[model samples]
Target chain A: LAKTTQPISMDSYEGQEVNITCSHNNIATNDYITWYQQFPSQGPRFIIQGYKTKVTNEVASLFIPADRKSSTLSLPRVSLSDTAVYYCLVGDGTHNTNAGKSTFGDGTTLTVKP
Target chain B: EAGVAQSPRYKIIEKRQSVAFWCNPISGHATLYWYQQILGQGPKLLIQFQNNGVVDDSQLPKDRFSAERLKGVDSTLKIQPAKLEDSAVYLCASSLDSRLAGRTGELFFGEGSRLTVL
Candidate 1:
């Protein structure tokens, strides 16, 4: 399992774009980067995932550089509802069927203010 | 489709007492997981089950915590002589399958059972 490091907290105003970066210097070739968002008293929800390059979804976008050592999660037009904890995880895409076993870092807490 | 279901939304018990939490995964999901989330921290995987079989339990405190999935559907997690540090939210999540090619490894989670050890 690759160890991931992210900022402890971030603050943003409504309608602003927020970007959270995660560093995994030892990421392996088969490892895929996945991001999840968790709200108060709720379970973590999948935001986006990518192995390399950029992957965009309705909720967020994931950008992975060529070295695969780092990845960024970009949230567009943030709102108060977007304030939540974001987790970045790296794991072997092929064998991580039981994704629960993947290690979860402390995560970045995003505070969106109106 | 119905998401994962968990029971007894809240539980309060003494440090030496025992408690149990139940979970029912989504229909057709082949992989289930039990996670422990302490306040202000990310969830930690306690165990993972592939259908009715245990796939991994390295982080589970086997001496005091145990979990089982029967008939590849519903599951139960039990804690005997719980400790103060055991107070946290117990989350249950499921996925279609573990294989990456077969699925995206996206998990559907239940509301979770909040446990307070007094």
Candidate 2:
């Protein structure tokens, strides 16, 4: 599995844009970058996923550089409720398969304050 | 659709005692997993199952921990003679298909089962 590097924590004010970047230099060719947000006492929820370039959805946007060595998760107009730990995982997302799977890192905890 | 389900939200047991945790994945998901999360750390995969077959269990401590997903549906994780270090949240997650060997979406996780070994 490819290892990932990201910030341990980040602080943001309401209405501001927040971007969390993760570096996975050894990422596999078939690996996809995915981000999940986890609130206190709850399981992580999928936010967005991308193989390359950029992908956006109702909740967030993902930017993958040309090298695929790193990626960023962008959240717009953040609110206090957005406070949670965000995990950046790189994998093919094939559940039963083996080799170069997803490894969960200590996520970047974002604190969205009032 | 129903989400993954886990039970006995919390557990407290004495050292050397045994305990078990249960999980029910979303309908139609063929893959299931068990992870251990110590406070302040990201979850670590303890085992993985493709239906009723074991996919990977390299991280599980064989002497103490065991898990089974019978009939490829609900699953159970058990630890015999729990230790102090076993005091962590046991998490259950389900995914639609296999990754490298199989084929889909990110895993859906259930609220974890917190365990405290006294």
Candidate 3:
């Protein structure tokens, strides 16, 4: 599993776009970047995933560079409901479905102010 | 569709006592995971099950923690001789069989069982 580093906390206002970047210097060739959002008292939920370049979903957008060394999760028009911790995971199922066993760091706590 | 279900959403016990949590994954899901989330930290994976078999449990504290997925659909995680540091939320998550999907699948999590070891 590739290790990821992200900010401890970030703040933004409602209706603004919030971008959280994660650094993974030792990413693997088969690794795919995935983002998950966790609310208070709730489990983390999938936000978006990308192998390279960019991938957008109804909830968020994931931008990955060609090197795949890092990835950014962009939440457009954020709301107070979006205040939660976000996790960046880099792995795939190539090695015995280990992706399902990927490690999670102390995620970046995003606070969306009204 | 019903999501993953966990029982005894909360448990409290003194140190050295035992506690157990039960979970039922979504129907047809083949992969199950148990994670421990301490306050102010990310959830750490303790074990993963592929159907009725164990796939990974290197992170589990074998001396104290144990988990089983008997029918490959529901699971139970037990902790004996609990310590104060074991106070945290025990989360159960499930996903489709990635081997059949040919790609990593998203995890569906339950509400979680919060354990408070005094």
Candidate 4:
């Protein structure tokens, strides 16, 4: 189990880029960093995931440093619809499935103001 | 492709009452999961099932909360004598594989069932 720490909340105007970073000091060798976005009253949607370096998708980009202790989620040209709670998770993806659970933290609430 | 489906998008009951939530996973998905999310918080995994068999349930409050994924496809989560703390959105997700030996794909989630315990 890896505990992730991220900012509690952030405020930004529309058309701005928002970047949220997470820290996992004890990330395991087999861990994978993943991000999720949750809109109001809806289940979370996967944003991006990466093992190391950078991974980009249509919605967001995930950046992982070489140490694997920190990761960042960059949302380009965020809009009002992008205002949601974002979660950062680090997990030993191949660990004991019986004991390994994807525990979500408080999450960073990104509020895109108009 | 059809996404995961859940029934009773909203549920309201008094404390000590019983409630149940139903979920239908994506076709051919072998793994199913249940999660609980409080207001303004991230979703928390309560249980995971692999082909009708429970794989992990460490976070589930077995005394009051129970879930079953029968036939390895659809699932049901029940709360007996629901508590105030049980007031949250119950989410269901399905994945192709989660055994750690195969390629683990992303989870497809349902709209979720919101429970309110008065």
Please list the Cα RMSD from the true structure of every candidate, rounded to 1 decimal place: 2.2, 1.7, 2.0, 2.0
Off by over 4 Å in 2: A94-99, B99-103
Candidate 2 CAPRI-style tier: medium
Candidate that scores best on TM-score? 2
Clashing pairs in 1: A97-B98
Question: In angstroms, how far off is A73's CA in candidate 4?
Answer: 0.4
Compare candidates 2 and 3 on lDDT and give the better one. 2
- Model 2, residue B4: distance off in Å is 0.5
Residue B41, candidate 4: alpha-carbon lDDT: 77
- Clashing residue pairs found in predicted model 4: none
Tens-place lDDT per residue, model 1, A1-114, is 557899999999999999999998877666688898898888888788888999998999988989988999999999999999999988743127233335788899999999
Cα lDDT for residue B51, candidate 3: 98
- Candidate 1 chain A has its poorest 10 consecutive residues by lDDT at A92-101
Write down the lDDT of every candidate, Cα atoms only. Answer: 0.87, 0.88, 0.87, 0.84
Top candidate on lDDT is 2
The digit string of per-residue lDDT tens for model 3 on B50-82 reads: 999998899999999999998889999999989
- Tens-place lDDT per residue, model 1, B37-114, is 999998898998999999889889999999999899999999998999999999999987775453456767888999
- Measured against the true structure, the TM-scores of the candidates, in listed sequence, are 0.94, 0.95, 0.94, 0.94
TM-score of 1: 0.94
Q: Model 3: runs farther than 4 Å from truth? A: A93-101
Of candidates 3 and 1, the better by DockQ: 3
Worst 10-residue lDDT window, candidate 3 chain B? B98-107
lDDT of 3 at B59: 93
